[model samples]
Target: MYTEENTARLLPDVAVHAQPHLVGELDWVGMDGIEVPVRFDAGDGDVQRASARVGAFVNLRRPDKRGIHMSRLYLQVEQALSTQTLSTATLRDLLRGFLDSHKDLSDRACLSIRFEHLVRRPALRSANSGWRSYPVTIEASMIGEELLLEFGTEIVYSSTCPASAALSRQLIQDQFAKDFDAGKAVEHAAVLAWLGSEKGIVATPHAQRSVARLRVRPAEGAAFNLIDLIDVTEQALGTPVQTAVKREDEQAFALANGGNLMFCEDAARRIQKALDADKALSDFHIRVEHQESLHPHDAVAYASKGVEGGYAGKGCA
Candidate 1:
């Protein structure tokens, strides 16, 4: 089927290939948040004390005609390691540079960093306390001239379910009363024996592990303190976890748990209202996951941080 002209064209070698007339649309997908460990705050303290790690997400843009440069993202982050100064402001600057590096395709960018911000505290009784870290994090995004910033912390609180414990007490009381009302009043020895048996044991209520996740978008020139959210969340949970716990502190923790028995659902609702009432956050995604011991499955519930979606008070919460 070959002609003289076609054979001549097919055999010739060329230095250039034809350029594309059009390009395809690309989805610049990414892993939004990843926990990374690196040395942070290394200039002022001992190596052990100075050791710090923070989670971060890099901004990326996919090419319409070809592919995205993934290795470049990793290179930028690895460079931050030796520099050692990473703050909210520094992160903002870094992201802008990232976006500008790939301006031909994508128009939006996002980044999130999670890390433990530590503080040293003295022991309650002994002078033997060390350092404890709090979960501190930041999230940011840029689309054209518009910018979004968010920050938060996650804290643990123990709350005991009072209703469940009260029922246990009532059941024990009824059993004692019925025994006393019988033809023969129960003897002290017999009562003592009953108390030693499983039949007379009172079931203590279970405590719940609660988490508070908050996101905020502050006005221009406004200061959004992440610690403020930490304080509010710990308070909302009733009892915050202690960094240094002696016998007395342990007892106090137990007492707090005995008083606040909340299911995973209770924790979510309480936190949702707290954020809703606050003027700081208006649109957020709030999720609480409860790891259960009684069952193999975990209980979870979610609420949007600052939206007007009707809360139906359904399912677990």
Candidate 2:
């Protein structure tokens, strides 16, 4: 029978501890897509467990070391993340553990976890609610005593084209003028009947499902308030997609869309203004995409807090 002593004699660490043929330092060396169980505070003191895909990395400072302890990284992620609620402090400690394991082999470490955050949303003008899942990514890195944390989430909502609304209003006016002759005194009943008819409202503004990808660098000592950020963004947009709806709720949603006509630029600017006012977020990047109903292409806009050396105001991050 195979025993521990015999197994140890049979397998050696030659390959793992071997020196690299090309002796040059790598910027980062580690593994990704490690399956891990994580928990986070989802507002109101509620702790939620989620399945997360983790990426862990540490700098390869030693030119002679060919490889890192991949198993060590995986174990650290599994043990640390599974036991603690994911937060800035937990992430910082996790990254520090990474560097500690690699010791002289690395000076910096990074960790990322991606998962779906589920929230219960109440229907507009209804006594019902449903669950919505938001894709969220939390990333942390520790480099030379400086720890950075970034939170990213995707928010799905509705966007109505402003230009399309204007054109639709013009068409409706033209239809109304055709029904009633100029300088003719129309009866209230006739006008109301006509307004109720399909021919009366001949056009509608094109609205489509839109997505907002937001990445924010929280201020120092700020807690992970994921739901708060989501609520702020959805409130600013004012047209978040509904989970459950009745006719009344549908009508209310339509009214909201009518009142909140926006282009991609408008969505981005609205989110920018809201994030700028948030004291918890020191820097942020916003990318809003309107999946156009009138055209095959999507309309996109990008914005940032204009923080120096932060977000750079370019991509969605």
Best by lDDT: 2
State residue 51's C-alpha deviation in candidate 1, in Å: 7.6
- Count clashing residue pairs in model 1: 6
Write one digit per residue (lDDT tens) for candidate 1, span 1-317.
68997996786443122226544444454443433554433223422222334333333333233444444445555565335455445566656655665575456666666667675645444445766676655667777756677766566666555566788888888877765676776688988998887768556565555555544554455454545556566666666666778887677677676655677677777777766666655444456666555557766767654344422232333
Q: Which residue pairs of candidate 1 clash?
A: 159-260, 160-260, 160-261, 161-261, 282-306, 284-305
What's model 2's TM-score? 0.95
- Per-residue lDDT of 150-227 in model 2, one digit per residue for the tens? 999999999888999999999999999998998989999999999899988899989999999999999999887889
- Model 2 accuracy (lDDT, Cα): 0.90
Q: lDDT of candidate 1?
A: 0.58
The backbone clash count of each candidate, in order, is 6, 0
State the displacement of the C-alpha of residue 271, model 2, in Å, after optimal TM-score superposition: 0.6
What TM-score, computed on C-alpha atoms, does each candidate reach?
0.66, 0.95
| Candidate 1: stretches off by over 4 Å | 1-23, 29-64, 69-88, 119-131, 178-201, 208-210, 215-224, 308-317
Residue 60's C-alpha lDDT in candidate 2? 88
RMSD vs true structure, all candidates: 9.1, 1.7
lDDT of each: 0.58, 0.90
